[model samples]
Target: MLNKLMHSPSHKSILRLLRNSMASTTPMAHLLHDTARQHWRLLMLYLLFVLLLSFSEACLFATIYQTMRLLLGAPSFTEIAGFGFTQGQRLFLLLFLISALQMVASMSRAIAGILSGRFAASCQRSILPEIHRYILSLSYGCVSSFKIGDLSHQATLAPLTINTEIDERIRLLTEGLLALIYSLVLFVISPWLLLMAGFLGFCIILTQSWLRPRIRLAALAVEQQRRNISGTITADLQVLRLIHTNACQEDSNRRFANEVEVFDQKLKKLSNLRSLLEPIAELLPVLAAVLLGTVSWILSDQQNGLLIPGLATFVLALQRLNIRLAKLALSLNALTENQPRVEILNQLLTPSGKIFRRQGGTPFSGLKEAIVFKNVSFRYSSRQEETLTSISFTIPRHGMVALVGPSGSGKSTLSDLLIGLLSPTFGAILVDGKDLQTLDLSSWQNSLGVVSQDVLLIHDTIAANIAFGSPVVPSPEAIRHAATAANADGFINRLPQGYDTMIGEHGHRLSGGQRQRISLARAMLRNPEVLVLDEATSALDSHSESAVHAALDSFSHGRTVLAIAHRLSSIRHADTILVIDAGKILERGTHDELIAARGAYADLWERQVHGLSRPHLHKQL
Candidate 1:
C-alpha cells in the first residue's frame, strides 16, 4: 500500500501542492519512485512483519482487559455460561497467559523493528551508489558549475534523510495499525466511546494537515541555509593561508559567525513550531480520555447499566487510542517536513538527459598517422568571445609537438580539445583522417597519459600513487622502473618506508619538485602512446628540471609528445613548434628554423634567454 502511494498518480498532485506552498521547483516523485522500486521486495516483507506484530499487539491488549476484569471481581463470559474456573484460579491462569502473550508480542515486535531497520538501510545503500554514479556521469562543465561543498553535502545527506524518512514512516504505520485494532475492539464494547475517539482523531488530522505545509517550508529553508553554511566554510578554509597572511582572521571569524547565527535562527524557528504543535498533540489525547471516562461512568450508572469490566476495557483502549493518534500526527508532520529534503535529494541524484557526458562510439584503437585539427573553434557557454578560433595543427606519430604562446593565448584550451575533455563548437579533430568524435573518448583517454600543472595525489603509499591508474597494483619491479624513468626512485629510496610510506593528503609531505616527479612516474606507469605535459616540469627547480628533461629525451623517441610550456628554453629541441597568439597559430616550424625566421617564436626566445641570464648579470653588479 505504501509502495502504491509512492508511485500513485495522486502523489503528483501532492507534489504540485507542495511546490505551490514551499516554492520548490524541482520535481522529485520520479526519483522516490525509482528508489522504492529498487527495494520493493524488502519493503513488502517489512510490512508483512509489521502486520503480524500489530495483530499480536491487539491480542496483548485483549489479555490485559480480561485480566483486569478477573482482578475487579467481575464475572467472566465463561462463568456466565456455567463452565468457568473460580476467580482465584481464573486470575492465576490469566496472569500466566498474559505473561506468555506479552513475551511473544515483544519478541515479534523486535523482529519487525529489525526488518524495518534493514529495509531503511538497504534504501540508503541503493541511493548512495546511484547518486555517485550519476555524479560521475554528469558532464565536466555541469559538475564544475556547482560548489564542491554544496554537491558533497547533498550527496551525503540526501540518502541519510531518505533512510530516516522510511524508518519513521514504517514505525508510524505499524503503530497506527495497532491503534486501529484497539479502537475497533472499543467500538464493539461501546460505540459512544469510539465516536468520541473518532472526533479527537479527526481534530488531530486537521491540525496536522494545516501545519504540514509550514513544516515543509521551514525544513526547506533549513536545508538551504545548511548548504550555504557548508559552502561558506569550505570557501574560507580553502583560502586560510591568504586570510592569515593578510591578518584578516577577525573578518573571517565575523563572517562565519554571521552565517552560523542565521542558520541557528532558522533552526530556532523550526524548533518553536514543533514545540507549539507537540503540546497541542499531547493535550488533545488527555482531553479525549477524560471525556470518554466520564461518559463511561455515567453510562454505568444508567438503567442500561454498562458493566464495570466493559467500562474498564473501554477506558484502557481509549487511552491507547489517544497515544496512537498523537504518534500518528507527529509521524505525519515528520514526513511532511522531510518532503523538501526528498525533493532536493531527488534533484541531485536523478540523471538528467541533457547533463550527462556523451557515451557510445567506436573504440579508438591507437594513433595511426597523425592527430589533425582542422579549423576548430570553441567558446565556453559562460563566455561570449571564442577561446579558440580557426585553429589548425597536426601532431604526427613519434615526434614532439610544442605549443608556445603568451598567457591566455588558447594553448590550454587547444590541449583540452585535443584530450577530448571539451568538444569543439565548430570544425573537427581527426585521428588518421577519421573524426575524433567517431572514436570512443574513454579508449582515447586510456591511450593518452597526462601530467598537468596541478597534479592530484591520493593519500596513499608511493607505489599505490604511482600505479593508481591500474585496477590491480603493478609489480614492484614495474613500479620501480617507472619511478626510475621519472627520476623519482632516488627520493622514494630515501624516504623512511620507501614505496610503502604514506603520502599525506595531496602529497603534502613531499616537496613541489618531488610531487611533480611522482606525478611523472604515475603517468609513465601507463606507458602511453601519447604523453601530454602541461607545465609538468614548471614546478621543479633547475636541477630537477634538467633531470626530467633527460628522462624525457630517453622516453620521447617512440611516443607522440605534446608539451605546453611557459619556460621557452624547455622546448628548444622540439621537432615542431607552434607559436599561438590570441587563438591563432602565428608561426610553426622546427625550433631552430623558427628562431631563424625571427617571428613570434624568436621574440619569445630572446625574452626567455634575457630572463634566464638576469641572475648572472646581477652577480656581476
Candidate 2:
C-alpha cells in the first residue's frame, strides 16, 4: 500500500512542485538533482530508513497512549470476545510492542547515519573533479580576469559548499517527512487541535518568508567582502618584496585592517539574521500548544474520561512535530545562506558564462618549413585600439629572427601569438602551409620552449624547477647539463644542498639574475624545436649575459630562435631583425643592413650605445 501511494499521481505532483520551487529560488537545486541522480540507489535506501523510523515513532506513541489510559483507570480498548486476555497480559503485549519499535528505530537511525556519510563522500568524489575540469577548460583570457585567490576559493571552497547544501537539503526533507507523519497522527486524535497547529505553522512560514530575502542579501555581501579580502592578501603576498623595499608596511596594515572591519560587519549582520530564525520557529509552536490547552479547558465539561489519554497523546505528538519543524527551519536558513556561493559556482561551471578556447582534431608532430604570420591583427577585449596591426613575419626552421621595439610596442604580444596563447583577430598564422588553428594546440605548444621577462618558478628543489614540464623525468646528468648551458650550475653547486635546495615561492630566495638563469635552464631542459626568448637575459649582469649569449650561439646551430630584445647588442648577430613601433613594423632587415640604412633601428641603436634617455628616443622615433 505504501509503495502504491508513493507511485501515485499526487506524490509525483508534490515532487514536481518541490523541484520547481527549488529551481526558481536557488541555482543549487540543479546541482543537487544531478548529484542525486548519480547516487539514486543510496538515496532511495536512505529515504526508506527515514520512513521506517517515522513509523516506529508513531507505533511507540500508540503504546504510550495505551499505557497512559491503563494507568489513569480508563478503559480505552475494546475487549476481544474470543481471546479474553487479562489486563496483565495486555500490559505485557504493549511492553513487547514498544521494545520492538524502539529496536527498529535505533537500527534505522544507525543505517541512516552511515548512508548520509557515504552519500556526502560520493558527492565530493564526483563534484570536485568536475569543478576542477571546468576551471581548466576555461580560456586563458577568461581565467586571467579572475584573481588567483578568487579562483582558488572557487576550486577549493565552492565544491565543499555544494556538499553542505546537499546535507542541509537532506535534513530538510527528513524533518519535513517526520513532521508530516506526526501531524497525521495528531489529526487522527484531535482534528480541531491540529487545525490550530496548522495556523501557527502558517504564521511561522510568513515570518521566515519576510526574513529570508534580508538574510540572502546579507550573505551575498559577506561573500563578496570575503573574496575581496582574499584577493587583497594574494596581491600583497605576490609583491611582498616591493612592500618591504618601499617601507609601506604601516599603510598596508591600515588598509588590510579596514577591509577586515568591513568583512566583520557584514558577517555579523548575516549571523544576526540567521539567529532570528530559530527562536521564532521555537516560540510559535509553544504558543499553538498553549492555545490548544486553553480551548480544551473551556470545553472540559463536554469531555469524557477517555479525553484525558487522547489529549495527552495529542500534546506529545505535537511536541515531536514542533521539534521537526524547528529543525526544518534551521535547514532552510542554512540553504539560503549558501545560495550565493552556489550561484557563483554555477557561473563558473556553466559554459555560457565563460569563453572557451577553440580546439582542433589534427595533431601537430613538428614544424617542417616555417611559422608564417600573414596580415595578423590583434586587439584585447578591454581595449579599443589594436595591439598588433597588419603584422607579417615568418620564423623559418633552423633560422634566427629577432624583434626590437620600445616598451608596449607589441613585442610580447607577438611572442604570445607565436606561443598560441592568443589568436589573431583578423589574419591567419600558417604552419608548414597549413593554418595554425587546424593543428592541435597542445601538441604545438609542447614542441616549443618559452622564456619570458617574468620568470615562472615553482617553490621546489632547484632540479625540480629546471625539469618542471619535461615529458619524461630527466636524469641528474641531463639536469646538470641544462643548468650548465644556462650558466646556473655554478651558483646551484655553491649552495649547501646543491640541486636539492628548496627555492622559495617565485624563487624569492634567489637573486634576479639567478632566477632568470633558472628559467633559462627550464627552457633548455625541453630541447625544443623552436625557442622563444622575450628579454630572457634582462636581469643578468654583463658577464653572465655574455656567457649566456655564447651558450645560445652554440645552442642555436640547428634550431629556430625567435628573440625579442630591447638591448640592441643582444640581437646584433641575428639573421633577420624587425623594428616595431606603435603596433607597426617600421623596418625589417639584417641588423647591419638596418644600421647601414640609418632608419629607426639605427637611431634606437645609437641612443642605446650612447646611454640616451627614453624620452629623447621616443621623440626621435
Candidate 3:
C-alpha cells in the first residue's frame, strides 16, 4: 500500500512534502529549544517536582516490599513483630506508617501528573495561535493547494495528539527510569532476584521488537482515517443546509456513514492491537519467575549458597519494574505513530518569510489614495493557463471604477489583485504610487472593506458577526448605524432577538439577501478608504437589490470603490468601466462613449436591453 501510495500523485506529493517538512523541523525545534532556554527555571522546577514524585513512589514500594518479606520469610510471626517492639502496638504502628507513606506517594504522583497536564496544555494553547496565524497568513493560492479538511486536521487534531505525547510519554518515560533505579537498589541487597530481573529485561526487549512497530502502524492508520473523515465531514457540513433542503439527506447520510464506517474499522484494529499487547507482555515476567524460582530452589540446597529472608523484596521490586517497562513501551509506540502528524503540523504552522511584517505599521504616505495595477498578471498555482495577462488599470482617487466581463473573464482575477489576495506575477501594484511591497500587508488590508458575492458569515450572534475581527470594537450604536446603511437593520430588528440572534451555521437561518446585507454591513462598519464590491448585490432579488444599491451608492460616494459586477447597469454609472474578457481589457470608457462607439460594452448593453443574450452570438453591437 505504501509503494502504491508513492506511485499515486496526490500521496506522492505528500512524500515530497514530508521531506520539506522534515527540514522544516529545525525552526520549530529551535522554537521549542529557545522557549526552554528562556524558561529553564520553570522547566527545572517541573522536573524537580516530577522526580520528587517518582522518588516517593520508589521509597514507598521499597518499604512495602521489605515489610512483606519480614512478615513472610521470618522464622515466626512473633520474631517479625518483636524486631522493633514488644507488643501488637509495634506492628500496628509499622502498618500505619507504611499506609501513610503509600498514600503520600499516590497523592503526590497524581498531583505531579496534573501539574504536567496544565503545563502541556498551557504550552499547547500558546502554540495554537501561532499555528492559526501561520495558516491564515498563507497566500490564497497556497491555501487552496491543500484540502481544507486536511489543513484543519493538521491545525487542531495533530497538535492535540503531539501534546498528549509531551503530557503522558515524558511522564511515563521518567517513571520507568526511576523504577529501574529502584530495581537496581533492590539488586544491591540480593543476587538471585537481580539475575532474574536481568533475564526478564532481555525477554521484554525481544517481545517489544515486533510489538512496537505493529502498535505504531495501527495508530498511524487511526490518524489517517481521522483526517479522511474530517475532510468528508467539513465538505458536507459546508453545504448541509442545501443538502437537506434539496432532499439529498439520504445521500449526505450515506457519505457520512461511509466515512464513519471506515474510521470505525481503523479504530477497531488499533484497539485490538492494544488489547493483545499486555497479555503477551505478561508472559515475559511469568517466564522469568518460573526460571528464577527453579534456580533459587536448587541454589538453596547448596551449603554455601543460602536463601535470604528478603528474597520477596527483590521479587516485588522486579515486578514493579516489569509493569512500568511495559507501559513505557506502549507510550513509545504511541509517540512514534503521532510523530508524523506533528511533523506535518509543524510545516503548516511554520512562518513564511514572504510576508513582510511592519516595523510599527505607520500610516501610508496617502491613506485615502487610489489603487493602481501597473501591468499585472496572475494564474492560479494549480492551473497552467494564465487568468490575467498583462492587465493595467487605475482607480481614480475617491472615485468609483467597475470591472465588467462574462464568465471566465479577468474581472474576479483583477478583484483578487486589488484586494492583495494575490500578487502580480510580473508587475508592481501601487497605492498612492508607492510600491505595495513597501507597505505592511496586514495593516494595508485592514484599511480596505470588501463585500464579495460569496457572503461568508460566521455562525454567531448577528452583532458579533458584524463586528467580526474589527480592530476597533463595534459599539451597539455603531453596529446599528452600519446595519441601517446596508439596509439590513429593518429585517435584523424584526428577528426574535434582533442583533443578539445567532446566525446559526454559516447564516443558514437567514435568507440569501439577508446574508449578503449583513456582509455589506460588516464592510460598511470598517469605514475603509478602499471598498471592494465583487457582485455585492448580485445575489439579491430586484427588491433587495434596490435597497442594497442605494446603500452602496452612498458608500461609493466617499471611498475609492472598485466593483466587479455582471449587471451592466451598475457599471454604467461608474466613473470608468473596464470591459475585460479572457484576462485582458477589450475597452475602457464612460457609459455614453462606449455606447456610441458600439464596442463590447455597447453589445452587452444592447443584448441586455433586449433580453439575456449569450456571448456566443457576437462580440459587439
> Which candidate's TM-score is highest?
2
Tell me, by lDDT, which candidate is best.
2
**Model 3 Cα displacement at 544 (Å)?**
3.5
lDDT of 3 by residue, 305-416 (tens): 2244344555566667667776776666666567667656556544543332233344554455667889888877668988998888888788888888888897877877
Question: Could you tell me which 10 consecutive residues in candidate 1 have the lowest summed lDDT?
Answer: 1-10
TM-score of 3: 0.85
Across residues 1-621, which tens digit of lDDT does each residue of candidate 2 receive? Answer: 111211223223223443444553334555555565566678778878988998898888888788777667666352433356677877777788879998998999899999989887887788778667666767787787878989877777765786777667778877898898888888887888889889988998899999999998999899889888988898899889899999999988999999999999999999999889989988878777878877876776644567777788888888888889888888888888887888777666655556776576578888789888899999988899999999998989988889998899999999988888888899989989888878888888878888889999999999999999986799999999999999999999999999999999998899999999998988889998889999989999999999998887788779888999989898898889999888999899998899898777877887889855455445636
Clashing pairs in 2: none
- lDDT: worst 10-residue window of model 2: 1-10
> Residue-pair clashes per candidate, as listed?
0, 0, 0
By TM-score, is 2 or 3 better? Answer: 2
Worst 10 residues of 3 by lDDT: 1-10
Question: Candidate 3: misplaced stretches above 4 Å?
Answer: 1-46, 57-97, 301-308, 350-362, 365-370, 469-471, 612-621
TM-score of 2: 0.91
In order, what is each prediction's RMSD in angstroms? 5.3, 4.8, 7.1
